[model samples]
Target: MRRIVRTLCSVIFILHGLSVGQVKTGADLLFEKYAHLVEGKRIGLVTNHSALLSNGKHLVDAISESRRARLVALFGPEHGVRGDAPAGKKIIDARDEKTGVPVYSLYGQINKPTPEMLKDVDVLLFDILDVGVRFYTFESTMSLAMEAAAEMGIPYIVLDRPNPIRGTWVEGFIRLDSLRSFVGLYPIPVAHGLTMGELATMINNEGWLKNGVRADLKVVKMEGWKRTMWFDETGVRWVKPSPNIAGLATAVVYPGTCFFEGTNVSEGRGTDRPFETIGAPFVAGEQLARELQSYGLPGVVFEPIKFTPRDIPGAASNPKHKSIECGGVFVKVVDRNVYEPVRTGIAMLSALKKLYPNDFQWRNSIDRLSGTPMVRLRIDAGEKPENIVAAWKVELAGFGKLREKYLLY
Candidate 1:
């Protein structure tokens, strides 16, 4: 019996080893190739839990141990320096324990680093994990940091990480200039399908930087990463960068269902599986799932399920402040390659409207969330989801052409 048990354990270990051998992330590539770039230089790092060495040590600790980079100030984004602050909350400056370096909060009083913040550092390094969606807020924070670095004439380095949503496919509407917000500061689609480093390059060349703010920018490119590979393919461990984005499944459905945040519906924020589960007070889960299934969307399946919103970490959890119990279907994406997130989200909204005309109403704040009122307006006017999606094709194609110039493997 002991021999049989040992054999079973061995099989499990082997399976785990096989899974970890598949793909490498941008963070993995950076540490392997260019750990010496910041050696001896006082470095300021804008990163969080996603940045780590291959042996599972945080990059801050690893760099401190290395003879190369002199780890100085640690910068945090929306979730704070340690990635513990709730989304959109202000992050306070503190000290890191592993390295005892001062940690600065970029999500607080200043979205960009002041000249004071960069005073001690000779070089600025950025290495945050990004979801391939527009409204995630991390990209915006990165952009702001770049702008600050450019303004200060500091050498900026972006340690590349894989676009977990992959880099080959682009989707959603091209954000109009007037519609820009903290969620989307530039004219890009909802899912830009580029790495943080690639987006930084595009922003620099496109003249998004303030006039006279010239930055000596360098991107440490990833090794053995493909634009088509998904996060699961990348053998690296999945760390939850933000609270709601629990795993790869959540990231897969996020680009589509995240729009629900601008509405009265729950995007599963109060539950254990946010983004992967979504519902509204008026939704009939089984019926809605059936209708969605009839559309035959590729790479996905709809499971009609019911969930009551409960307060969870990284999400707003007050019952009195929150709306009624959500009752929508859960989207199980069977295939990522053929699944279109933006279209699926729009279809879901449309279906809700048709299914319960009296109860379904677009929240006025949706315009801010979508970067424009057009999506909300069209849905209200009884426009077909396909037609609404079709209207953005020309603009999306134009963005795609422009995006081609900045892509780096």
Candidate 2:
């Protein structure tokens, strides 16, 4: 966290007083600054449905209609351009329905843009909303795009947006190089605090790109935004970055609960309250909730819940524990500032393990999702969540220092 963020702990940062009214996104300020602008360039855009202006017009449309940039082709991330695909589903190349621009799928066989994909492009524009979780593949897509742009020697511009979970709270483990995967690419913590722009700068400056390469990275900084402001405080309408992440509350609990995806438990994927809730058919919801309540974790409470995950088409195709009523817990964040999402998640796992030693299952993916092998190993050895969290302090603090150099706000 920055000194200003720590100093102003008492002040509730919002889009007032310090800021005029609302957060003006980088796209919002496009017309203001014309230096290296996309007004008359061939641009290959990497964006999704959430890249919209305050007026409710999508950036893709606004860019095309403004006649500013000749959108040569479109690049779809993990969920495709319109956010229609399910998690981990591959997207095929197609043409944009509205603009007739050739759409390239970067989430499937082609993890990065090919030379042919960049042959006709002068620059690549990236604009996507991130929910501030490491496992979310948006940042990985952007990193690959940057690498492609660098290899092709084209300038890369990032249209910045607010980190919905704010930019001051850095938590969880710095991913080990051994655990590298599409879900956990860069060595960032689970709830990394930087926005897209700042992370891009870090990715470039820290030489984290392919073969220690670099990009001509340019980040359009958000105006009237601060490191302390959460999405709700920005007065900007929330857009679901992906299918399951539908609300701010879900995002708040996601950094922790999303680990459930690694196990047989459903992380509320097919429920109306995804990420905020987690369960499996074998869980005793009320008993688990009662056990968690005794922990008295800060800024959060767990409530017993019962739900049957649905196999909703387009949203969740074959959800975990599909169509089965499961005992669960709802993570309600009361004061996000004090909440430790990673710890809460670890505590939840600990409670489950202690309560049902034989019933609870620990899948291998837990180590991958957790970014290190220690978390799972320690939990399996009956180590308390606090002790596990305390063990991560040295590495987490080191990452915090390295992260400070790239912060924009």
Candidate 3:
């Protein structure tokens, strides 16, 4: 009886130890261990609705209710502070009802905070959940805010979070300097595998900020996060970073399917499964699926699917092919570990162009979306997807080496 009791106690102790090893976001660490950094300082937080604590409280509410820190102002990114605004919609400045603090819009008349906007701010804090894609726009917002913080002579702090996709897998072409836009700013690859904190560090150290200005940046890193762990594996609750990115599965295929946005095709917008479903009015679902499957793309499968686009208020209000039934393939990633998003997108484009030579057309946005005209040019010239993907190997290799200095986890 004594031996059995001792064995039971040991098992309980081991179970508790395992639970303690779960990943904690930088926001969790901020309050638990780094409260002194913000204590007594007037803070201006650049964040959206996705910033939440492990306890499931929004960051805005936590900061407003905190006695140690004074939340003097709030800055919102592309989406409004609450993350309700749709893509490309201009957000207007207003006062936050809950905190009764002034909320400045960074997405409207300006993409960066003016010096006047930061005159009352002593420190700037950034805490938004970002899906690790170059075209996602959050990084651009973060970089622009960092520039503003630098000009204002205020310290910028980033409460780091896990890169929803694994941080070890970097792929795709590096954006050309000539084709730089909000979607493909700087010279990073389409699928940059760095967390927001790591990307901020790179932007600062690499002098990517405007006029080569660097912010006094400090990153409160996460605890127990690994480069190989996806968001679901991190034990952090999933908040839709943007309206379309509903779950971890959506994020997995987003890197590849997002390319369709540059074409005449409906990239599964205005539907229940945005990025997972890809089709245009002209596409034959079975044929597209069969073609995609023939490529033997790793860790993914395609199934014939037909969907109709509709206006989703906060997500895709005026998405492509609204109210029209489209035929396309549903991309199901079976194993994210081996799946390559950018390459898969290239393959899909190649197949589409071949199957519908007359109907398939490349929009001008392709150059900006792809970060280079070569992707559009090559596919138009009947180049195989393999050759096109292999063309970027050298540049991608060089970028991999440069990114090593900025990797946090």
Top lDDT model: 3
Clashing pairs in 1: 23-235, 26-161, 39-68, 40-68, 299-335
Residue 129 displacement in candidate 3 (angstroms): 0.7
Best by TM-score: 3
Worst 10 residues of 3 by lDDT: 13-22
Task: Kindly report which residue stretches of model 3 are placed more than 4 angstroms away from their true locations once superposed.
Answer: 1-21
TM-scores for all candidates? 0.91, 0.94, 0.95
TM-score-based ranking: 3, 2, 1
Q: What is the C-alpha lDDT of each candidate?
A: 0.80, 0.88, 0.91
lDDT of 3 by residue, 4-58 (tens): 9999999998886565346899999999999989999998999999999989999
Task: State the local distance difference test value for candidate 2.
Answer: 0.88
lDDT string, candidate 1, 228-347, tens digits: 878777676678778778788899889889888776677787777777777777788989998888877778888987887766655544521254566778888888889999889988
lDDT of 1 at 399: 90
Question: Which TM-score value belongs to model 1?
Answer: 0.91
User: Model 3, residue 206: what's the lDDT?
Assistant: 95
lDDT score at residue 181, model 3, on the 0-100 scale:
86
Query: Per-residue error at 279 for model 3, in Å?
Result: 0.3
